[model samples]
Target: MGNEDFKQDKLIPIAQRSFASYEEMYRIVDFLNKTLKEKYNIMFGLTKNNKDGSMVITIYEF
Candidate 1:
């Protein structure tokens, strides 16, 4: 692969919320939000139950 591909891979395309319970999910969400803001200066749009009862988190680079 090329350097660009490697970099892209580092930016996760899909992330599923942890198997932890509701409370844990909130903690994870908050942690992820803060971490992204601090490290990449990015904000993610978190989606819970996009379909059925699944949770998805997506972070787009600005």
Candidate 2:
């Protein structure tokens, strides 16, 4: 099978805060996951968390 070429748009920083709690993080992550899946058909997994407790989202490309 031939390979499919894909191009990604520039990444814009997106931040969401709710009551300064970790529960807000889950909502943001879930939103990001669904958006990426619907828009790019890609699945991302959590790679790491910073010392300050912020998370890093990883988009895996096939």
Candidate 3:
């Protein structure tokens, strides 16, 4: 639909975690995303904190 129909509240962060390496964090996020995206309408995100080298995982409700 349109941007007006988009609800910011629906896209919320439900959980978060920090990891030492991207590979390990990515694996878990990727698996959860693949398994939960359709049935649960949930998604996972990965990013690096600018101040630190650790990888960050954010679980979201879609």
Candidate 4:
């Protein structure tokens, strides 16, 4: 992608949290994504931390 497409203001990581299991993280992120995505312009993502194997939830603003 070009520099303009990778602007810092485009995607911002606002918050993050660690969970014990994928099920727990998925539930919370799914709920937040559905409830807040349209009205708040926010998104939630889930990933596993490679180092510790913990579930990570990331809150992003777009």
- On TM-score, the candidate that comes out on top is 3
The per-candidate count of clashes, in order, stands at 0, 0, 0, 0
Compared with the true structure, what per-residue lDDT tens digits does model 1 show for residues 27-47? 766787778755774545566
| Model 4 lowest lDDT segment of ten | 2-11
If both were scored by lDDT, which would come out higher, candidate 1 or candidate 3? Answer: 3
Best model number under lDDT: 4
What local lDDT score does residue 13 receive in model 3, on the 0 to 100 scale? 94
Tell me each candidate's TM-score.
0.45, 0.37, 0.67, 0.66
lDDT per model, in order? 0.56, 0.51, 0.78, 0.78
Which 10 consecutive residues of model 2 have the lowest summed lDDT? 12-21
Off by over 4 Å in 2: 1-23, 47-54
Better of 1 and 3 by TM-score: 3
Ten-residue segment with the worst summed lDDT in candidate 3?
A: 1-10
RMSD (Cα, Å) of candidate 1? Answer: 7.8
Note the residue pairs that clash in candidate 4.
Answer: none
Candidate 2 lDDT, tens digit per residue, 1-62?
22334423433334323232354555766787778765766555453344565556555544
Residue-wise C-alpha lDDT for candidate 4, range 1-61, written one tens digit per residue: 8753554358789999886766566787788888987798888879998888888888888
RMSD of each: 7.8, 6.7, 3.4, 4.3
